[model samples]
Target chain A: MVTLKQIRNSVLIALWMMILTFPIMVIKVNTIENIVIWRWMNLLYIGVGTVILSIFWFFLINRRKLEPEERKRSFALKGKIETLKGVLAKPVVQKPLYAALLVIIIIFPFVSSLYQTGIMITALMYVILGLGLNIVVGLGGLLHLGYAAFYAVGAYTYALLHRYLGLSFWVCLPIGALSAMLLGILVGLPVLRLRGDYLAIVTLAFGEIVRILLENLSQYTGGPAGISGIPRPSFFGIKMSLSTAMNYTYFLTFALVLFTIFVVRRLEHSRLGRSWVAMREDEVASEAMGIDITRAKLSSFALGALWAGLAGVFFSAKTTFVNPASFTLWESVIILCVVVLGGIGSIKGVVLGAIVIILLPEYLRAFSQYRMLFFGLILVMMMIFRPGGFIPAKRRVYTFDKAQLEESD
Target chain B: MAAILDASQVTMDFGGLRAVNNADVHIDQGEIVALIGPNGAGKTTFFNVITGVYKPTTGDVRITAPGKETESITGLKPNKITEKGLARTFQNIRLFQNMTVLENVMIGRHCRMKAGIAGAVFRDRKTREEEEQVVADSYAILKKIGLETFVNELAKNLPYGAQRRLEIARAMATEPFLLLLDEPAAGMNPHETRELDEMILKIRATEKISILLIEHDMSLVMSISDRIYVMDYGLLIAEGQPKEVRANPAVIKAYLGEEFNA
Candidate 1:
């Protein structure tokens, strides 16, 4: 089943995305614009029209071609419908997963309304961060223990730019992301020479250095107290403030979550993704096969940092305040746990892991100071019992094709 | 006959010990040659030196290919050496265990993959077509080596004999003009050894790829090798055709003991 909600969200996001890109577009469209008279407006109009027509054509074609059987097959191949049906069709004893997801979805909206939106917003931000780390640690097998360093760079970037330069939050987001990505490559290059546990140690060291630098650079980074009263994301002429625009923060968070998922999903199926996996499985063999190991490793690091930076920018905007405490090494460890707990390379697993690792501890807050005890125990138990996490990639069975069999005979 | 591979005074020293002391050998085009010796006599070391896994302390290793002049292979990286019409299989069966047998073979054709990152990522029509061709070529190699059925199996899961054959299939995937097989029959049973002999002959005849093999099995070596070099104490003691080398006094001393000869 197609999700109208997702499509509608995509449209909203696409418009906001185009707005963010306006500066570059304006610069590139030199001599062809009257600012607002006919040049830029005509391009936007034509682009939107083309996008709508293409989407319409695709939906119409698929609709026409899909028979009941074909529809079922396509859904079976790509959708969650079959998975949901499979879960529900199981014995009552085995149907806990179906009931559990239902409960969470139902509870999420109600909980967001009742409790502080801060916790929920924070959780959503981590979901994006965890997914980003998953691309490196889970898929690439690089074991990047310093992912939080990139997060710090992003938050610090947005915080400093908005505070000093008076640049809008929207403007700082991409700049922060770019800064984080460049730093990611910088860290990735030196550590690429190391392998496995060594690589982890080097990254861990890198993270500490970044934290120490921020703490020491009082003039630039605001030392320990950190930057405060940072602006929130705005919609048109309206600001996402507490009294009138609280819901806008949640909307912006959700939009980011959706966008992160879209890009990551595309990346997972791409050639670069396959190369990352190949490198992870066997580096010697990967290099022997003509893959430039250095290039693949650097790209993973860059993309992973880019994700953290984007998440950090959103996080600082959402909080309207930033401190060193918010970007601690423990935060990096927590993000790492989410990716591993989710089953490394599995996208759904990472999302589920981020939700559970974050929200589960919050739910057990009644236990108070003992919450840490329960969280640690749950993590240990999960590692021991379901090491593959909630989902694992299936191993395919190889069989000979008929013509080849005939030739062999 | 033109020499496909020429090694002059190849020496490898490990600390104070000379592992390979000034060994010189030449391999003719389309010939099946064997380097035979007792354990730790530096046959494998010589293979390593010639294949660019180890740089010889002092030597020149050159390969003369058709329409191409003799090129120095010494000091080149293994993959770079492979691109220069030379490839090798490992003694311990270094197949990428987690990758499929087909993928392991496809990796050998990695240098041949013309698709760039963009093409590979998007699976563009040209890349897709190229990938299909690679798969076909890999499948064909597998079929020739009696491993077509195991094409999709993980390399680690194959039986001992098939794993050895898979290594050969993988090496062939690189389309090497000169193939090096390091202890190809190291762990094989007698029946498997006989089959490998037939397989190697077939490969030489059909593929037209020269074979430089290191084998411990004397019977297999004597039967299949066009010429054999016998080494003892990191020095070449004998070199000639199977019958000539097998009967040589030094080879007999190296093999059977002086007590047996007396």
Candidate 2:
């Protein structure tokens, strides 16, 4: 049933996709040996993958033909995902299911190995960072390319504080957050009059400055060699085994993730959250609507950076190390990717995005080298194909259906 | 009647170009005023100055808020002006497109509501009650604007005419004493334009909110406006009752030359 037109279109699209994904698949660099391995088998995988994708695309086009012209622009993926979301949306089904999920997460470290728990902690930390950046980039619609700087500030707050002032993890946590918030305000103030690319460049500059400062100031920050032998967060000064410590870090991160989710969700639906989104949508119009544009933007930056700081503190404690290497622009990019790839302005999407971006490459270690390549492709694909993202945020709607109440009666 | 809004000797200059000359416009308590001008007549610039988007080079913008003393809002931030019960819509629709229709209106309630991070996170009784009222009031605004069906829909997904209406509804949500509409009927058809005229009158009649609109649609302007101010090339050419302004030779020669007779 394949027509010449369909076959031609499919081949064109498949080949285009192959070309995009092909270069990354072939070039695998072995960092330890400093040599490149041009893998030919990836060509085979691409060949097969493109064939399957073409078939899928063919059917998608056929189905698309039945829809109206404007509607035909989107793929069948939208409808399929919408139905899936609808099924999972009911409180009756979701309440118990989320509770079960909570229980499983609570007991996960108990059953898993220390290695698994360690990576799990890292992934959860990224989730918190992703949410923090989400407030700035997603909801506030400010492109922040310097998120890692705040994270570094948080890490250093703990690292430098404990070294100089003899502070504990519990004591430095709030201090680290406040310090990052101070930096956020400082950054936010100058960028108040800037928007779009100008703001992006400024934030990028800020991140690089923080990292370079940390690296150059060897006496304070330990330069390229980074500080080690930092103590893991003590559980009430109980001298615990390494495995217990891993489990403890996992639980702490898990708790923070839940708290972040709760707080972010609340903030997203509140007056301040509304103002942030409004500002993002149209600053002039938002100002005319009586939203204090300066306060809203600053609060978003400050609050967004606070989460990153908390995550930063959590990260250093979990790894028992602090360094400039970890807070690179690439780290900021990945966190931005998590927010963008998940769905900007969506709490659930950010969490899922963090896990996918952090955990997927871990599961497929062979493709670890190609992680950034895949991320770039995923971001491009998401922007073009599904701009709403993997699990697009459901519009928060207040139900005033008195009919439903009466129907229950 | 005391003017709700008063802008006197307003002049705006951008570098070497003078966008608005020494102009004076006032909205008295409960009046529908029109600011009509040709393209680049500096109508929007004048609006911008009044809304605090620009600091007039040598003019004063003042508002006499209900139960509050008169305050000069010249060079004040646009948010500050809005806080003083002045809200405006754009010539180009500037809605929160990614957000829901209801949410767009709720943003108008932002300055009116008081809730910070603590209230948002904790949802205390007062915050909870306020949140409920926001929803109720926003929904009511939507219902009044005939956008109840599209309350949950994204603002981007709305029809063009409906999007324009949503902007008005959002402006109304701010509970302003004076609502400014800049080219509200620019892209709308005649039927939509007629509907907008009715809605403008409804707003004035029901809410007791004075309005100032800049428009090219003379029919909509002449029909609804109690008073009219005509501008041409940054100059306020004429001002009087609609008929008086419409008949003025300067305004007729500059703008309404072909259309208005008698």
Give the Cα RMSD of candidate 2: 5.0
Instruction: Give one digit per residue, the lDDT tens place, for model 1 in A1-409.
Output: 3347645754665576567666665445335654433247644864586457545545644554677567666555545776776766678846687578657744554456635566777788888998899889876889888889899889889999988898887899899999999999988888898989999989988888888888888898788888898888877766434733545676677778878887776566444665677788777656544456787799888999998999889888877877777767798899999888988888878888888888899999999999999999889868865788866543334455778556544
What is the lDDT, from 0 to 100, of the residue A32 in candidate 2?
A: 100
The per-candidate count of clashes, in order, stands at 1, 0
State every prediction's TM-score relative to the real structure. Answer: 0.76, 0.89
Q: What share of the true interface contacts does each candidate keep?
A: 0.25, 0.87
Q: Residue B185, candidate 2: how far off, in angstroms?
A: 2.1
Give per-residue lDDT, candidate 2, residue A212.
98
In candidate 1, how many Å is residue A72 off? 30
Scored by CA lDDT, what does every candidate get? 0.80, 0.88
Where does candidate 2 chain B have its weakest 10-residue lDDT segment? B252-261
Worst 10 residues of 1 chain A by lDDT: A29-38
lDDT, residue A374, candidate 2: 75
B1-262 per-residue lDDT for model 2 (tens digits): 4688889999999998898999998888889999998899999999999999999999898888777788899988898888888899999989989889989999988888988889999989999999988888888888888998898899999999999999999999989999999999999999999999999999999999999999999999999999999999899999999999877989878864566458
Candidate 2 residues A1-409, lDDT tens each? 3477777777777677767877798888999999999887887788677877777767655655565544434546666766787888888989998999989998889998888899889899999999999999989999999999999999988988888887888898899999999999998998867899999999999999999999999998899888886778888999999998888888888888989999999998888888888899888888888988889999999999999889988888888899999999999999998998898888889899999889877876778788768766766767766688777777787787775324323
Candidate 2 — which pairs collide?
A: none
Question: How many pairs of residues collide in model 2?
Answer: 0
